[model samples]
Target: MLSFVVRRVVAAFGTLLLSSVLVFLAVQSLPGDVATQVLGKDATPTAVAALRDKLHLDQPAWERYLEWVKGALHGDFGTSLVNAKPVGGEVGQYLGNSALIAVVTVLFAVTGSLVLGIIAGLYRDRWPDHLISTVSLIGMSVPEFVVATVLVLLFSIAVPVLPAVVLYGPDASVGQLLPAVWLPAASLAIVMAAYIVRMARTSVIDVMAGEYVTTARLKGLSTWRVVTRHALPGALLPTLHVIALNVAWLVGGVAVVENVFNYPGIGKLMLSSVQNRDLPVIQAIALISAVVYVCCNLAADLGAMALNPKLRTRGGRTR
Candidate 1:
């Protein structure tokens, strides 16, 4: 178990380190020049050259990547070329807002998915399963922007209960932001719940079909006890990894949802930075997203190992 954990941790760290390289290369490959975007197209070549030189954009890609990595290791993501502000400071503020929404989204999604999934699995081929499967399908098929639009129309326009877009500044308190976060969180939750629900339902069915569950049932154990004790523990392992992926996605992949609702999250910020060619901010967001993905996956693996003794015994290898 210790060796397995050590290996996973080392792999996670290597994944993050490699992700930083990809992020740097990706940011460097974006169309349009950072200096050109900052100084405007009317700016002369000489002016752009000076700005590039000042920002070290004139340096070789390898040299710049090394410097950026060094600064990142020191918690300095460099200054934003467009805003002329510390990338870390600006990203930190937006990250807090994103985390708030992501937390709410996960709470809603995980709770709802677990309940609905279990019900659907237990009642497979029945009305409950049909209804849930239909809803899940719609959620999976519909895009986040479409979901956000429908939500805005239903709640904001038709009902007028929740705010359509976030009205507060980036520094808004949670209290001030709560009412506004619902629409965005719901949009994300709906999308995430789809994947989680399907995975959970499948896992539950598989677990229930296993021989151990049959043995427990044959022992005359109550259906509820058999499921709760023998089935649920194993069922959750697969769903957990799915949940982790969604959680990681919520960190930086909700650009459309955030944009539709004008939410001040990492996603929206990353998009804005992309448009303005703010490489520092873009790269920072990329690195953060990658870190979240790797960490979530690692946590999920650990959780699975905890839930399944066989995994630890096998040293996390599948036969």
Candidate 2:
């Protein structure tokens, strides 16, 4: 188990390094000059050139990349091209905001999906199963923007209960964030729930059909007992993997939802960076998201191994 974990961590680090390089290259290729963005449209050629030189934009790409890489190794992501603020500090702040929203969404989505999927699977081909399947399909079919808009219209405009847009202050508390957080979180949750529900339902159905499960039922165990004791444990393993992937996906997927609700998150920061051609901020955010994704997947793999004894062995196979 230790060796497996070590190998996974090592591979995740390698993937993060490669992704950082790709993110840097991709951000570097984006159109527009950061110097021009910094100076403004009316800035003279000489002024822009001098500003570029000051920002070291005049250096070769490889040289700049190496410097940035070196700084990153020391926990510095370099300074933002537009604001001259530390990228690491800025990203850290935004990451917290993004993580809060994503975590809330995941908790709600995962819990609801698990219950719904289990009930649906247990009552397969029945009304409960049909209802869950239909709802999940509808949830999956809608885009986040549409869902966000509907939520805002229903809850904000018509009901006047929650705020439509997220407002962030210097010292925003959880109470202050709730109105802003709920809509985007709900928007993300609705979509994410669909995936979790489907995976959970399938896993439950597969587990319930196993010989061991049949034997347990033949022993005259109560329905709930059979599910909770004999079936749920194994059924949950596949859902754990799906949940991990969704958590990673939330890092990127929240961008559109954030935009819809005017939320202040890494997603919004990345969008603004693109609009302003802020290469440093863009690259930093992309790399951070990549790291989050890689780490989440690593955690998922580890969790699966921990839950299933067969997966812990060196020669055993795991689905």
Q: Lowest lDDT 10-mer window, candidate 1?
A: 310-319
TM-score of model 2 vs. true structure:
0.93
Q: Estimate each model's TM-score.
A: 0.96, 0.93
User: Could you give me the TM-score of model 1 versus the true structure?
Assistant: 0.96
What are the lDDT scores of the predictions, listed in order? 0.90, 0.86
Candidate 2 ranges with C-alpha deviation above 4 Å: 169-171, 315-319
C-alpha RMSD by candidate, in order: 1.5, 2.0
| lDDT score of residue 233 within candidate 2 | 85
Which residue pairs overlap in candidate 2's backbone? none
Candidate 1 residue 194 Cα shift, in angstroms, is 1.0
Model 2 scores what on Cα lDDT?
0.86
Separately for all candidates shown, the number of backbone clashes (residues 3 or more apart, or on different chains) is 0, 0
lDDT of 2 by residue, 130-176 (tens): 99999999999998889999999999999999899877742466677
